[model samples]
Target: MSDTGRRSRILQAAIADGLLHPQRAPLAAFMDWERVTSNVQHLMHAFPSHLTTLHAFAVKANSLVPVLTRLRELGMGAEVASNGELTAALRAGFAPERIVFDSPAKSWQELRRALELGVSLNIDNFQELERVRQILSETPSTSEIGIRLNPQVGTGGIAAMSTAGVHSKFGVPLDDPGMREQLIAAYLENPWLRRAHTHVGSQGCPLPLIARGVNELVRFADEVNLRAGFAQVRTLDIGGGLPVDFETDAPIAAFDEYVAELHEGASRLFSGDYAIVTEFGRSILAKHGFIAAYVEYTKQVGGRDIAITHAGAQIATRTVFMPEAWPLRIEGFTESGEAKPTGTAVVQDVAGPCCFAGDLVARGRELPRLVPGDIVTLLDTGAYYASNPFAYNSLPVPGVYGVSMAAGARPEFSVVREAQLDLELTAVATE
Candidate 1:
């Protein structure tokens, strides 16, 4: 079946099962489990046979416990950036050895907990390294330690997503005076620092630029090993930023293209001298998921049609705030979950429920005329949409589900997370 047909069937089944309300303007996120698994397999195939790669799914992209659990089952490790993400990984049954703890501002307690768990650590800055050193003084650890490097690579399409920019706050800048010497001395002084990590950028980052950053990381590692007289850095965590094909029904990320680019630009990385780790967040799950919401009302303003939907800044925070950087495809459907008839295409602005004027998902786009009770499906939303919802207006978090379909078999759906109540803290409130 085509993507549209499968989505229609899943939405119809969700409505029939009472998981989605046809008339209540409810919002829900859905993931194609088969597509997700297929993407993982494709990612695994991109690596060379001689190199050992651990594809750690970045939990910040989609923190749904069931989603993490499923990724773990597919032989993927978890890359957590916060205490909450660490807890989620643990709850999802990811082993400590399979988890990488990385955060720019890891608190004392968070660092302590991570050390106690013996998870891999990618120290962000000198202050963070000091904190880790202090923790190790009190309690010895067996965690794989690494230092994040800002290769000072050129910026990507989005400044905010660029991690290796000259002024980026993510990692220690290698271009700074005495910074390289400091890093080498740190590695020599601490034999436990056996890994090196660098994430060039995310989303809009170019493949060659990302590869260049990885090449710089490899060169740095080689230098450290040469200076230390042994292989002090045995692993390279080339952070993931493989962009998804939002324009097409691509089932997986562009792993083949990305790997080819890396091979061309950073051939040394494939030499098989070091274990490789990837912290891919968006590319792994972005294209496999989407958000479906009801159009509550329609209006005409300044001679242009408008659709007011239950999805806006709450679920599509980046799109609403940065539309150009994160443009999402919108598909219209009738109230009964069938694809809307193709008629005269009208320029409409899809607005969300947020009170601010900037809460629009797509503006000035040519989409079929949307009416009240119609469904609007936001395509390619699996990664950062509902999973990273904005709490503006105290909106409730939408429920998420995983849908799996096999050839000549009935589709199976499992709820990944329940919809949050209007006031989730009501039970704990003592008034």
Candidate 2:
């Protein structure tokens, strides 16, 4: 609740002063810089017991330079998944060591580039580990190495994001007997190995799942260090998967509570020597962003009210493209006053302007009587929506604006990326 008033003021300002590009009216998404920074500050205060060496913000969440720059100013690091994200991190002023490279299928060229920059590499699998070994053996020493471990906890917003589950394709599983010993042996044999890491899942809500993963990870880390007989382990990277409050009034997981539990779990197993690192992607940036799109049209389908929005699965696929879900409502912008809630009280199915029959955002839920030009603000669109857009349909992507929760703040967002242009050949009418 810190700076709650400031957050409101900044959000109001964004609705008032943000400049939309030509043809990109009624901005699609806006990031609240102040609120995001405040979240970071809250996290820093929460984990006072541990040397939080690097609160690396996941770049894949929102790779916008303004977003990255704002996070950098808050003394946060960057967790990049690809060479392009690494480039964005560097451009945004992250130190080489502050950048953590993670990917299951990285090209040798990308690995070489990161190594050359001295960034930390979180090797995904044994094959990638051997690839690193071969590359580093030949090339001059460049990058520090870390291994990503899968606690196999199986939790997240959706099955697709659940990386720690038994069937996950991420990090080497720690539960398997002798797997820990093998990984430790690999690290002991490799001089570049200095860090061990793991991520349970993304968009995780329940804190207990995270605690389980961390506790188990600490046991694994302790075993690795004891077996190696060397204090080469300086970093324990518990990858980020903090959730954000969308349209629901329900409370999101407190940043401090999560950190405290994680710290306690780590403390129960290991002493005070290594830095406890967290890569928070969505929770750090999601709440601070809002997606404001105009209501396109209204229809009565199946005896229900359906309001189509300008933003579709092309922009927010996870939320909109699903087996029907309801997003939390933070605010409503319309010309009418206190419209009657006559529609179904349940979660309504809101569809986007896609041709697919299954393009409904939400289904069979109650929403206010809507009309064209009314604005709908998707509560938390800052994380994966903008950067991880679906390029299947050539729908015109809307403009993104960055807002600060500070006084006298103006629109300061650049095109983190341009939307893909639609091209179709039709017979031209001769003038």
Candidate 3:
């Protein structure tokens, strides 16, 4: 389908699924799962044979059960960062081999659980490797593992999110000759080590920068094959940093372009066979969903306009606080319930109802003349927004909804999870 036509239809499906709620709930968030699943399918089709093993959706991006279930059904794998994520993945029906467990500071129990379950574990440190060894010895399971190697390449949308480069705390530094030697020796000694992976972080990643990182990964894989004397590494996870629509006019990373580039890089860097795997979180789901917020009140302060909405940084902290901003498109509705074409005009700040003065959603930005009860759409928030929400000031988690659209079929949408409330009652009133 044409891009415009597809977007329109998806929007229509979202509205039908209640994704476009007229106002935000007291403590509810919503998602368009059908659009997200379809996007995944589209990506898989776009890459076809070039993509291997499977694309694992990063659970940290959005761990809503419905999202996980949809991805599980889509034949995509699960990339988990904690025991909760692992449990969530399993609960959503993801197989052991189809799930990737990667975290910098994993607990001993978590490691043991991963070993017991035969999940794909990505080891991040020598200490963690030792823990894995201890766990395997006790469990005696022939588990597959991957080593996360940080190339120190430095690529990210914001400095905080970038996992690559000199200052990163993630993965063993691939450039450190001594560290590389240690990793290889450890891998050679451990029978469970099966794959090598790296992620430079997410958001606003320049395409060329990621292409370079992929080349580095392929080269590192080649080195592992030659130095470690291992052949046919089953997986080479390049790590997910595919850019989502966050401010600027930066176009979405072309899946074909990236895969083709990566494939060519791999062919040049290695002779051993491997599956090119990616653990995409944001890019896969972000653009496919949004958060609908109702303006609670509006005020003019010091010659600046502030439209306060129920949606706040608590739900989408990254986009609001991170140096990188997500796309924010505001649609104005008149009291007559008629849509108004308010050019590209902008507003100063969109505030949330939080205790702290710093609690804001989108700031120093442009939006329409928003008033109380109008809806403000936070576009491309499907990835990390709702999934990583913060209840810093005791805000309740939001509700999530799912929607589906297929060829020659009616659109389908439903509330996957209800909006939860934070009932802080001092006493139950014993009687």
Candidate 4:
């Protein structure tokens, strides 16, 4: 079935099951389980089985425990940046060895904990490496410690999203004067540093840009090992930056193109000598998830039709704050979950239920006229929309459902996360 058809049925089933209500629960997120499973399966098979590749899901993308648990079940590892993400990974049943600890501002306590747990570590800077060295002197850890390298590969389309820019604050700059010698010396001096890491950017980064960054990482690893007089850098964490297609449901093609680019630009990725780690977050979950909000009211402002929905900065923070960078495809559905008739295309604004004037998700877009009691869906939003919600207007975090829309099967909705209460401190045990 087409993505739109499947989405309509899933929401229809959700409404029938009372998981989505126009009055009581105006906002709810849905993730297609089959689509997510298919995505993971393709990635698992993208490389040869002989090549050691740890596909670690970046926990920052969707921090929900239920989502993490499902990912863990699919034989995917966790790439955690913050201590809270680490805890969430553990709670979701990720093995210690399968978790990778990476963060620019990791506390000493966080480093010690990860080391003790035997999780991999990517030290962001020299100061963090010194602390790790000190900790190792007192207590030996089996952890594979590495340094994050800034490849200076230049920026992608989004300036703020680029992490490998010349002035990026992510990792050690390689192109800076004297830095190559300094980095090689650091690796040679520290035998514990057996890995090198680089994540150029997210979303806006293209496959070619990502491949270039990986090529730099592999080259640096070869240089470091050559200087160390042995295979010192045995692992490479080529951070995930496979851009997703927000315009349509096109994730599998992106991954296929990504593998092709890696083969062309970074063939060393498949070399049998080193183990590979990938921290893909958005690409894994974005295409399979969507946000549905009930349009509470309609109005005409400056001779333009407007739809005020329950979705806004609370659920779609990026869209509300940076609409141009994060443009969302808004679809209209009836209160009963059927597609709203597109008889006449009306150019109008789709506003969210936020007090701010800048909460419009779509500006002067041609779409079916949305009315009160209609549902407005934000497509391709599984990774960051509802999962990375803002506390603006003190809006409650909407419940998220894992939907099964298999062929010839009835649509089913399983609770991935329950709606958050105002005073609730602990997460709901949905899994």
Q: Estimated TM-score per prediction?
A: 0.97, 0.86, 0.86, 0.96
* lDDT sort, best first: 1, 4, 3, 2
lDDT of 1 at 383: 95
lDDT comparison, 2 vs 4, better candidate: 4
Candidates' lDDT values, in order?
A: 0.91, 0.70, 0.70, 0.89
Could you say which candidate leads in lDDT? Answer: 1
Could you give candidate 4's per-residue lDDT for residues 82-111 as a string of tens digits? 999999999999999899988999998999
Report the C-alpha displacement of residue 267, candidate 1, in angstroms. 1.1
**lDDT tens string, model 1, 1-431?**
77887888888887877667854328999999999999999998988867899999999999989999999999999999999999999999999989999889999999999999999999999999999999999999889999999999889998899999999999899989999999999999988999999999998899999999999999999999999999889999999888778888878788989999999999889887899999999999999998999999999999988999999999999999999989999988887789876686788999999999999999998888999988899999999888988889998888888998887566688989887756645455534
Q: Candidates 1 and 2: which is better by lDDT?
A: 1
Give stretches of model 1 more than 4 Å off: 23-25, 424-431
What local lDDT score does residue 336 receive in model 4, on the 0 to 100 scale? 91
What does the lDDT read for residue 223 in candidate 2?
70
